[model samples]
Target: MDFRNLWPSLDLIIDAGPIIQNQGNRNGSTIVDLSVKGEYKIVRDGCAKDQTVKILKEFGLKEIHD
Candidate 1:
């Protein structure tokens, strides 16, 4: 099935944990925890920055961190 355009149509709760430690390097090198809840639960760790930025851009969601 074609599901590329499918987007959630429910209330979503997103939570992000603080940076725990630096993973050696200084280029955004740290471990972070994230969770998203809607109809299902989604969890991620470490680096999801790139993908998250892309998704946000796709939805024209800028100034999110500002």
Candidate 2:
């Protein structure tokens, strides 16, 4: 997924801290940290095939998947 287009206004923040132990299935789960909004977890499931889209929508960001 191209995050640059997905979150155009926000900058990605990478934390060098120790990886947090993820609970449950890690297959399609991703943890993203944004500059202004902090961290958000996008988990893909049967009900929600495109979790990133849902997250963007939740934050009132325009959907621009690449």
Candidate 3:
């Protein structure tokens, strides 16, 4: 789960658990956080979104329809 390079200059990272939460599994919320750039630069990086979703799927966070 080394996503450092994926999100370079990451500052504040908060653990969101497992991306999914329910009555049976409330402790499985995926890690989502607010990252800020150190310098005054504008960089559009899509790796974070892609990698996060991939990681969630890898961790068995299946979508439920009820």
* Residue range 1-66, candidate 1, lDDT tens digits: 864454464234333444344455223322222222211111333444544555545766542220
Off by over 4 Å in 2: 1-10, 13-49
For model 2, residues 1-66, the per-residue Cα lDDT tens digits are 565666767555533444334454334334443323433433333222355556656777643222
Estimate candidate 3's alpha-carbon lDDT, on a 0 to 1 scale: 0.42
Clashing pairs in 2: none
Query: Against the true structure, what is each candidate's TM-score?
Result: 0.31, 0.27, 0.26
Can you give the lDDT of residue 45 in candidate 1? 31
Better of 1 and 2 by lDDT: 2
Candidate closer to the true structure by TM-score (higher is better), 2 or 3 = 2
| Most lDDT-accurate candidate | 2
lDDT of 3 by residue, 12-65 (tens): 554544444343443333344323222221133232444556564575654322
Off by over 4 Å in 1: 1-46
Distance (Å) between predicted and true CA of 45, model 3?
10
Residue 44 Cα positional deviation in candidate 1, in Å, after optimal superposition: 12
Taking all chains together, the TM-score of candidate 3 against the true structure is: 0.26
What order do you get sorting by lDDT, best first? 2, 3, 1
Q: Estimate candidate 1's RMSD in Å.
A: 11.9
Candidate 2 lDDT score at position 7:
70
